[model samples]
Structure formats: C-alpha cells, structure tokens
Target: MVTSFLLAAAAALLNAQEPRPVEQDGHVRPNIILINTDDMGAADWSGGGSRFIQTPHLDQMAAEGVVLTDFYASANVCTPSRAALLTGRYAVRSGLARGVIYPHSDYGLPQSEITLPSILREAGYATQIVGKWHLGTVPDAHPLEHGFDEFFGVPYSNDMSPFPLISQREVIEEEADQTQLTARYTEAAIDFIARQAGREQPFFIYLAHTFPHIPLYASDAFLGQSQAGRYGDTILEIDWSLGQLRQTLADHGVAHSTLIIFTSDNGPWFEGEAGVRGRKGDTHDGAYRVPFVAHLEGLTPPGAVSRAMAMQIDLMPTLARLAGAAMPDDRPIDGRDITALLQGGQESPHEVLVFFDNDQIAAIRTQRWRLVLRTFYRNWLVPLEQFGAVHLFDLETHGDELFNVAEDYPDVVESLSARLETLRSELEGLPQRETPLNLPGDE
Candidate 1:
C-alpha cells in the first residue's frame, strides 16, 4: 500500500497542478534526467544478455540502479507512446489515437494538457528536452509551447521529411547528418548539464536519443567499432552518450543528487533484437515491453531488480511527487505513482495494463495473464473475437508467448475481457480520433 503521505500528495494535485514547498517530503530535491531511447530492444543491453549489441554504459547504470524488468510503454509507436509518457494519460483520452502525426499535420497535444516539464519547471527546476520531439513538428506545437525551456533536435523522426535539426523551433541544420546524430545530441546534453551544474536550482533533462531506430547511422569514431554491424555500432554510440552523461554529472559534483531514468519509447524494430515474439509497430509482447532502469545513488538501491509492472505514464506523477510538484487532476490519469515499488515494494501497483496499438485496444496484461484481443498483420487489423479466437498467455510460464491458454483460463479471460470492454467504452465515448497528417509521399 502507498503511504498516507503519498496518498495525500496525490490528493493535493487535484486542486493545483504546480509545485508546492518540499517540506512535506523528507528528502532534499534532486535533479532528474529521463533518457528515452528509440526502437531499442528489451534485451539489447550487455547486462540483459545482448549477444552482439554492446551497451556497456547502460549495463553499468543497471548494475548501479534498480532495473525494472516488466516496464512498458503506453503504446507501440512513437507519437502516442511519447504522448502518454509526457502527459500521464492514454493517447485515446487525448484524441491522439490511430496513427503517428507527421510534419504536415496541424495536430499536437492539446494546449490545456499539463506536461511533465510544466510541473517540473514550476517546481523551480530548469527543464529542457534534447532529442526527437515526435509529438508535433509545427512551430505552435513545438517543445517551447509544451513547457520546455529549451529544445535542440529534430521535430519528428529521423526518417521524416525535411529532416532538419532545430534548436527551439529554429532550424540549425537542414537535413541533419543522420550518422553523427547520437554524438551531437550527447554534446548538446553535456552542454545543458554543464550549464546546470553550478546552479542552485534542480534540473530535469529529457534526453530522447533518435538512433537504433532504422536506416542506422554511426559516427566516424564508432563507424567500425561494433561486431553486431551497423546496429551494434549505433547502440555502442548511445552507450558512449550515456557514459558522457554520467561523467558530466560526476564532474559537476551532482552524480549522487541526480535521479536518472533510462528507457525506450517502445520495443525494437526489425533490425534490433526484441528477445520476444513481435517487433516494433506491433501490439505483441516484445513491442511495448521495453527496458527500464532507474539510478539515484542514495535514494535507489544499487543492483536492485524490480519485477513490478510499471509504465512510462507512471513517471510523471512519480517524478512530480519526488520534486514536490502537484499533478493536474482535471482529467483522468492512467499512470499511478510507483515510488514505493522503486523503494523495494514486492507487489505491483497496477491491476491491469491496457495496450494500445495506435488508438484501438490491442491487449491487456495482468500480473501473470495477458489477453490479446487483436493482432495486426500486414497493416490489417484482425479482431480475434470476430474472426477467430481471443488469445491468452500466461506470462510467467510463457514469456515468449509460445502457448495459448485461453481455453484453460476461461474465468481469467472473461474478467480481462470485461475490463477491456469497460476501457474501450470510455475511449469510444471520446470526441472521435484525430486524423494524422499524411506522410510526405502519401500527401
């Protein structure tokens, strides 16, 4: 159970979504860094048993932090997954369901929504985001409008049109050198860290790396460095970026006081290893279950492994609580604060995790049971109940999802299906899903 203090804190968020004085919380305010990787696999790290990909820096962080084994992204794609991570609400609730937004799209997260950086910034933290801002590419929908003090990176995916690098909406490089992206993003992050080092204010850095996704590119320094080919080299470069971040923090004498979280936007793509059945863009097991690690020297126990079912949505409320920032309570928040689990709670905070492949409900996962309602094949939706059989897998016994036990666990399937129906009902009542801007060629 969550402590009374946390419960009260959560209650307080309903009134004012701003930072309160930290006297209620016992610990001093700590700097926070959220590193979100793109299309990286769950087992891509050396510590997680990567055969060819080398992620030594990530392995070292996991060795020194709590590794969350069952962490999941809210969705399987870029835009919606990022939306859930930033807003703590499902994309369906925000009307961002269906498909990814494009450069030509006029859509973005609603301005009424309060994002993670908005609360952190209100808490007297210098909030900045340095990497792919795939949520929206337009000027009005840029990170600056979404509460980030500074933004430096591409507006959309590296593969998107224009492909220009920007610094707070101003184009820095047209058609950014994709090969040197990892290194450049790292340099920008280091610069941000160095600026924040001597300041008295706590900092929140959202460093979203845009590599290991596809059309793989590597810097000259790491061009021929990995045995796993180009993908391996790209992962190594990202690892080096992590090392640089750690070194910068240490050099600035703020290593222990900073809480750094490393996770992926979703699962791996075709080239990267998923270690499970499906790859990116799918609603299957491996698609949304990405790697997650949290590091804070005295606060988080080193070398601890947590099997608690957590998600990217949880970060907003959890980080806000740690920073004494109040969350917005006007809307329904899908994320729950899992600080207790991070501190060594055995039980999971979540009763059920609903998986959204874009906007539609794809699956729901409980502690040991997973009910897959539908599957996507060749870009076509296949409703299991309509066409064939609803699939259920015992995650504990079948992590790879090799066996279907829906018939054996009829009661469990019924309960999960009922819950999924309830969730779907809520989504269905929303003011219709928004249409994304057409991709360049499609337009």
Candidate 2:
C-alpha cells in the first residue's frame, strides 16, 4: 500500500500544469537557453551607454524582451556568483564562499547539492552546458555527474595556465584559440539546438562565454571592428553570438516556445567602463549590477523595462516554478519565485541583499539604504563620512554612494543594521563545510 501511494503521488505531481507550455509542439515543458557573459557590466551595450562599441543584437534583445534595470549577480567573482545561480543560495551557504576553484583544487561544487540542471532533468528536460564550466575539474564534480548530459568548455577561466578546451572529460584541444572561442561555442550551440529540435523532450542549455575577462581576444574578423579597441571588438563578437542563437531559435520554429536570457556574471574587468563605482572584484554597485534581458513568447511583453531588483540566486526557483519542477525539500533555498515579477508584476521580490566580498560580509543593502561593515575590499567609503562603526549611504539620492548621510538618516541606518544582523546570524548558523581547493602537488 505504501508503494502504491508513493507512485500515485508522483503521478499527481507530474500532472501539475506549468506556467506555460514548455515547447511549441504541445509538450508539457518549455525550452530554456541562458546565455551568461563573463565580466560584462551594466552599461556595456550600445543602448546602455557604450561610448564606442556597438551591440545591435543585445540591444535588439532588450527591445524585444523585458529589460531589468536593477539586476544583480549574487557575488562579485565568477565561482560564487555561478554557485548562487545554480543552487539558488548564497555561495557561503553552498560551501563555496570564497575565491574561484582552481584547476589543481581537490574540491568543487558538492555533488550533494541540487543544481538547476538536476531539477530540470528530473522533469524530463534534456540538459546540456556549452562554455565555461568553472565550477570544478574533478570527475565527481563535473557537469556530467551534476545532471548535464554533455559538457563542452574549459574547467576554469581562460587566463588560467594550460588552458585546454575539454569536451565531456576529454581534452579536445591542448590550447584553445581564444580569438575563435566565441564563434566555436556559438556554432556548437546551433548544432545542439538543431539536434534537440527533433527530440521529443524539451531542452535546457546554459551557455557561459569566457571572453572580455582578461587578456582579451577577438576573432580576426572582429579585430579593429570597433573604436573601443580590442575590448570593444571582443564585446561585438559576443553580440554576434547572441544574434546567431536568436536566428537558430527562429529557424527551428521554437522561438515562441523557448525562453532566452541574456546577462553577465559580474562587472567589467579592467578596461571596460563600470558605469557605477568600483570594478570586478569589489562589492560596489558596478561589480554587482549588470544588464539582464529575458524573452519569453506569449508571456513577456516587448519593450518592457522593469526596475524590480533581482539577483542570480532567484533564477533557480523562478525557472523551477515555470517548469513545474518540484523544488528541493531538504535544503534551504535562498532564491524566491520571481515568476510574477517576470510576468509584469511591479514590486521587487527582494527587499534586502547581502554584499559578500570573498568570505567576509562587506555590506548590506535595502531598497534605498546600504550599510557597509567593511571597506577592505572596497575603500570607496573612506572618502565619505563615516558613522560610529559603519558607513551608510542613501542610494535613492546618492547613487554613487559618495556622500554619507548617516547623521541625518539614523533611523534608516538602524533598520538596515537590524536587517543585516538577522542575515549575518542566519548565514553563520548554517552548517559550515570545508570548500575544495587545489594543491601544488595534486593532479
């Protein structure tokens, strides 16, 4: 009787209707393609105030999709930000709270953790990842073991030494040509889409590009293509990749059934302009804030600009709700369901977000106020007036966070302090685990 009851429950759960059809062919699941760029900032695109470079494809996507003005990555660096996006939790909570996982590191994202691909695959979606997979290099922590059927990309950043491009655990190229990386990845993505279109199951693709990060490279065709120099040229190549993916979707006749997301992992590297204060490694507005555009046919209205504050952690739960996949019941999920906000809801689902600089709590921000606990990672607050123990800024009036108004807004500071304490305690109380790190003598 118990076995029969469990089977019946599973059937009932599977019958639940998703937010929308996953595929245009009347399939219960919809296709998802998330394209994430590395070290790209909020104003990197042509329409977003790029001074010299042009990103016509990205701008076109923003014009067609719901453009989010206040989108933020969960962390400043790549690994943590990626961990938060995949697990729907802070990197600290996932035991990957600090610097990136190097190739020599003995550890990676824990296998026990529930990833976005794992959840969707359980819901009968064909999962694949094509591009940077910096999460881990070990066999146990690879994308194949994590739920993706195929993984084609580098294990870490391009600047890392001996940068070989791996295809499903095998090194296909000892040293990949950085200039043609974007083009190659785009071609692979188009091929994957074409192959999946013939399958009965819906698909999920996570395309993480590794360009415009550091030691930038642009294809010969894109060289000297922009007045912004090689950096601008590199960005233009990424724009071309976007145009290719969109064309592929339309060609497959799955444009209406596919949800396309375009965003960056963090702020600009060294050369790209960070519209706000601070650059990539800092916890300032520029490091966290990024351009986000989501296109969903029959759902997201064209030319809609949303000011709702969203984060990378929120994607897991939001996509899960859209796919009718049951969220993990065993662990804590930091991400909230933003399905309503994506569908034209005005209010932001998040009221507060903690700024983490490596393993330390750098600051916390509410709707309009921010409280700085430490200025080590970012010394921008030193020039500004300081309160007794913390620095405060009213962002509504001072977007740059230059002037300190802690003396006048004591109540706001107190409220934000309280919120910060609650979050700090919550983060500290979670079971701590030793994050994996590469050693000198390791393989």
Candidate 3:
C-alpha cells in the first residue's frame, strides 16, 4: 500500500508538469516568434501603401494572417517603446522615459521589473534574442540577466559607435559587418528553431532586426535592386529574412504549432512614409502608429483585418496568457490582453489609449476622437516651437489632424484633459529617478 501511494504521487507530479496540447485549446504552449524591426514606418510595407519598395513576403504574410490597421507603439522613440513592450507597463513607470539609452549611459530597464521572456522562461520555454537589444549594455543589465537563455546580437543601435557583435556576453567582433547583419541574424534564428524542432518544451524567439534605421546597409545581392534606393534595399532584405524564417519553420514541421508576430519598434525617422504628419520624435499619429501583423496557422483567420486600437504594451499580457505563464502580481500592467481582438475580430480591450512623449503626457485617443494636451516639435532637425497648447481632432472625419474641433466638443475635451491630469498625478506619486541625459545625435 505504501509503494502504491508513492507511485501515484509521482505520476500526479509528472502530469502536472506536462503542458497542454493544442487540440485541447486550453493553455496550449505554442512556439512564439516576435520579429521587431527598427525605425520602420506603417507605410513601409507594400500592403501598408509602399509604392516604391516591394515587400512581397510581408505582404504575403498579411494576406495569410491577421493585419492590425490601427496598431501603435508605446512611445515615439526606441528605449521607452521597447521598455513598455517587454514589461507590459508604461516606460515612465520604470523611469526610462526621457530618451533612448546611449552606449555611454549608465542606466537601463530596472532589474526589479519583470520581462516577457522572464515570465515565458519560467513557464518552461527556451528563450533567445537575435538582434539589436538596445535595452542596456552593462553586465548587470545584459539580456542574459533578463531571462533570455541566449543573446546573439549588438548591444545597441547599429548607428551607435563601437557596434560590436556579441554572443552571450562575449564580444566576438569589434565592429560587425552591417551588410551581413540581417542574413546572419536570420541564420541564428533558424538554427535556434531547428534545435527545438521536435522537442516537447516550447520556445520563444525575439528576432529583432537592426536594419532600415539609419546609415542603412544591405548585402551585395540586394544593394542596387530597389527603386527607392538604399532604404528600399534594406527593407527588401528584411522581407527576405522573413521568408527564410517561414520556410525554416515549415521545413521543421513546426509551422502548424508556431505563433509569429511582425511589427516595427516605432515610426520612420527620415526616409520611410508614416502616412501621417510628423516622423519619429513628434507626438503626431504618424510617429506612434506602426504596422502590425500576426500569423498563427490554426488560430488567426486568413486575410483578417482588425482596425482595433492596440499598443506594443499589449504584447506582454496577451503573450503571457497564450504561453500559460503567470504575470507578476506585485506591480501594475498597463497592457490589456488582446487575444480576442487577434483571434475573433472583437472590439479593442482598451477604451482609451494614451501617447507619451518621454515622461510627459502628449495626447489621448478614444475610438473616434483624439485630444492633444501639449504640442512641441521634439525632432532635432525641426525647429523647436510650441505648435499649440491644446487641440482636439475628430479622427473619423478629419483623419489628417488638420482641423481643431475643441470648440465643437467641449465636453469631450474636458473629459480627456481630466484623464490626462489623473494619469500625471498617479505618475508623480511613484518613486522617480534622474532623467537620463540625452547624448548628441542620439534619438
């Protein structure tokens, strides 16, 4: 009787450790791949209205998956947007809202915060990051310490100085070849996926591409092949990398069991078309709005288009749910689970979306209206001046944001302004850190 009871207990423990299968559709653990591009605009892809550049693979992915039309980045810049994406919280909450982190800077995403990979890793998934990190370069703040099992990429943006190629904390190359970065990163991702091909344990790959940012570079094969010049060439290379990843997944027989997401970190900086006013640094719709596409063989409907409003912050909660991972209950998560919107075209979970320019409240957007609280040109190239103190826009009628409807909708303005103030007060109550000093030419 004693031996029998001990055997029964062992079996129960093993069963509890096993992840649910896909057919059950309850807490199924599928391989997740998040592909993030740097400084890509909403209109950079052919499906998103790029006439000069051809992004056939990306267009094909959109046609065969779900396309999010009104998706937004958490912030108009890199460090803050990335922070919000990884933590499921506003960048301001982590005190990383002032500007992008420079190589010489001594700070990064706080160690106390929980990251997406950390949660997924705890749930039995092998995690890897294969491109630009940009979060932090210090030893304590490296990607390896942030829950990623492996890190093979540059520490920051390619345009930054001393851009070396690193592999698990070791600088392999003093200066990595920019031209071969996309190809090399794709190879690394394919290898990682192939290793997990038939394994019972699921995997998560964050293939963050470092191209199309600035000072763009493409391999010899694609150097002069685009009508839009070097910028277009880099985009074409990125699209090719996507096709390669898809083929590798199919080859490994894991295509049916994987979830793939493709999006940009922020808006275009100088070259790409944002399809709206302003570029990367401004608080306009163009800077925050970006292209978002998701593909899951058995889940997302083919060619489905969702105009539901969502942000980069939503990825944490949504992915955590899909991965059967528990979120950190000790802190607030600003992102909402967008699973319904992704699978069934349901209404957005968020009633109002807030846009931040660094730590300050810049604007707020509802389903049909947008209220701009403060407006100033933050782009370094553009002259600094106050465009206005407060303005309201009817996005449904005037999507261009040219007309101010504040007088027509006084009540709406009053409500949104109050909401902004409430948020400001809440942030002020949190413990603050000294804002990072912006370095010259760092955006």
Candidate 4:
C-alpha cells in the first residue's frame, strides 16, 4: 500500500512538472536581426497588398511572422528615424528632428545617448551593423563608438557613395561594387554569427539596405528582373538579401534562436515617372506610414497580425525587453516596450503618438484616429505661432484620408482632440533646463 501511494504521488508530480497543455508562449528571448530599408512604402510587398510589386520573400516573412500593421517610423526622414530606432526616443528628444544629415555633416548622434545595440550588448549580445549609418559623419558618431562591435557598410547614405569609402577613419576613392557590398555585408554578418556561436554568445545585426533609395543601381542579375522595372528589381534584390540572411541562420542551426525585424525608414520617395502626382512632400499617410514586422525564430506567432500602434521609437525598448536589457537611467528614454502587443497581448503602445515637422510638432494618433495639424507657413515670420488647425481622421476605417473624418465620428474627434490639446499645451510649456539633450542639434 505504501509503495503504491508513493508511485501515485510521483506520477502526479511528473504531470504537474510537464508544461501546461495551453498555447505555446513565444515570449522567450532570442538573437536579433533588424533589416531597415530606406524610403520603402506601405504596399511595396505582395503580402502588404502591392499588386504590382513582386516580393515573394517579404510575403513569406509576413506569413511566417507577426505583421505589425500600425507601426510608424519615428520620423518621415532618415536621421531622426534611425535615432528613434536606436534610442527608442522620438527625434524631438534625440535632437534629430529637422531633416536628414549630409555626407560631411559635422554632427551625428550623441554618444551620451544609449543606443539599441548598446543596450543589448550590455546584456551580452554581440552587436554589429552592416549597412547605412547616416546618423552622423563625425568620428565620435561612428557605429563603433555608438556600441556596435563591428561596422562594415557605408558610414553615411548610399547616395554619399558610388565609390565606396574604405573605412570611417578615411574617405578613399574606391568605386563600390554594389553587388559586392551587399554580398560582403552578408558574408561579414555570417562570420559574426559563426564567431559568436563558437564563443557561445548571442548576436544582433542591423542590415540597412541602400538600394531602392537612390541613384538606382542594380546588379546585372537583379536589374530589370520584374515588370515593375528597375524599382521592382531593386525591391527584388532586397528580397534576395533577406533570403540570404535567413538561409545563413538556418544553415547554422540557429535560425530558431534569432529574432529578425524588417522595416523601412520611411515611405517611398517618388522620383521616377511614377511621380506624375508629385505629392511625396504632402506629409500625409503616404509620406510617413511604412511596413514593420518582428520575427523570433520558432517563437513568433505564424501569420499572426498585431494592429497595435508601434513606431521606430518603440524598437529599442522592445528589443531590450526581448534581450532582457534595462532602459537607461541617466536620461529618460521614450520607446515603449510593445513586446506584449507583438505577442498578441497589448492593444497599443500608447494612447497616442505625436508626429513632427521641423521643430514644430504636427500630428497625433490614437487607436482609431489620426489628427494632422497641417500648420502651413512659408517662413517663421508668422508670429501666428500655430497656423495649422488639426485634422481628425478615422485612420482604421478611411481611404485616401480625403474625407472629413470628424464629420463621421464626431465622438472620436472630440476624444482624440481633447487629449491632443492637453498634451500639446503641456509639451509646449515643458520647462527648459540646461541639460545635454536641451542643447541644439546641428540644424
């Protein structure tokens, strides 16, 4: 009798020890890869609803991973957006709000600001960046100084090159073999993984694509490979590049251990004959809304969708959470941890996110509404302070955004407007202090 009772108790304990037969939780921390495309658009990928563009690999990424439908870049341009991606703060706080940086721009992002890789590396991640680093041109602003263990691509924008510079330390006049650059970046990244796997360290890679942003150069193989012409071909190259990265990880048997994120800096910059309308500068949904997706090998929900409000500003904190890193205490950081939403948890990162133009804050967004303060002024001479009245739109249910959203959901407009007004008034009156961030940007 005693032996039978012991056996029954052991069996009960074993059953309890087995993981509960509930849905698997994909919240485990993993290695990371972030691929950021420059000036990519909303519907550029087939999975994203682009009928003309052929993006099979991208479609697979969305299909096999969680597609974040409402993600926004922190800024509509490069420097600000990149800063937000790294620091998890809006351009306003990162001191990168005005526009993109020049090739020889004197300043870059400040070292005082703790970057995304810096945060992860502190938590034992082997961090590297293999593409555009347009954050700044100053030596102190290079990726090495900003926390990456390795840097192997253009120090500034790709347009800053045709002839690639050898190192950030010196600007040489060597011509860039665009194909070789991409291949070398991939090769170098793979080597980093091999090195880390040997040393038993995890890795983080930020691969920024330079093609499709530009002077439109393509390799012989990828050029004109699609009906969408050179532009579609360029996107195809991006897709190919994604395949290479995925294969590299899988070959190493570490694919399931890595979490890859794919997104763009901003919306497409219309420069081709496609620019017949020339409204790229209109600063509407078309100007800023871009694709954002997060993937954790064997972890993320497949073909799942998260309609949460995410932004480039949210990535740093989100990744930190995945890697179990701490937010900086020396200064306030802005990126909210939306990992819960990514895991099919949260409704949104915040009640709303503010959009900006120059030093002036411009728009606000809630769950279902977007309010653009299209305050237009040719010059600063308008002591008028704020000339742009706010526009309320039901972004979740609108098209073209040409319709007066306030005319339909008067309640949404009022609720969103009241919150926007209060936040704006308080931010406008935020007290000034003699602090590091309070200092002026190169603009």
lDDT of each: 0.82, 0.79, 0.82, 0.69
Candidate 2 at residue 246, lDDT? Answer: 90
Candidate 1 error regions (>4 Å): 1-27, 271-274, 432-443
Candidate 2 local lDDT, 282-303, one digit each (tens): 7567778888888776556688
The C-alpha TM-scores of every prediction are 0.92, 0.89, 0.90, 0.83
lDDT of 1 at 394: 93
lDDT of 1 by residue, 1-443 (tens): 23453455445544643332233344356688899999888888887778777788888888888888889988898888999999998878777766777778777877777899999888788888998988876566789998899998888787777799888768889899998888889998899889987777888999999988788899899987887788788889988999999999888777866789999998888833544778788868888988888887555667888887888999999998888888997889989998876765667878998898766788989989889988777878888978659999998998887788999989998898889889898865565345545554674
Question: Taking the tens digit of each residue's C-alpha lDDT, what string does model 4 give over 1-443?
Answer: 22232234334435453221111132334678899988777667778876667888777877888888777777767777788788887766756776677754577888777899998888777888887888876778888898898887776667653446444355443666665565666677777776765445667899887766766766777877877777777888788888888887777766656778889887777731121111223345666677877666344567888877878888887777667678897776666877776665548868788776644556677777777766334433232225433566666567356555666666776787688778666444332111132224443
Candidate 1 clashes between residue pairs 3 or more apart in a chain or in different chains? none
Alpha-carbon error at 296 in model 2, in Å? 0.9
TM-score of 2: 0.89
Model 2, residue 249: displacement in angstroms?
0.8
Candidate 3: worst-modelled 10 consecutive residues by lDDT: 17-26
lDDT of 3 by residue, 209-232 (tens): 998888899999999888878988
Better of 1 and 4 by lDDT: 1
Full candidate order by lDDT, most accurate first: 3, 1, 2, 4
> Model 4's lDDT to the true fold?
0.69
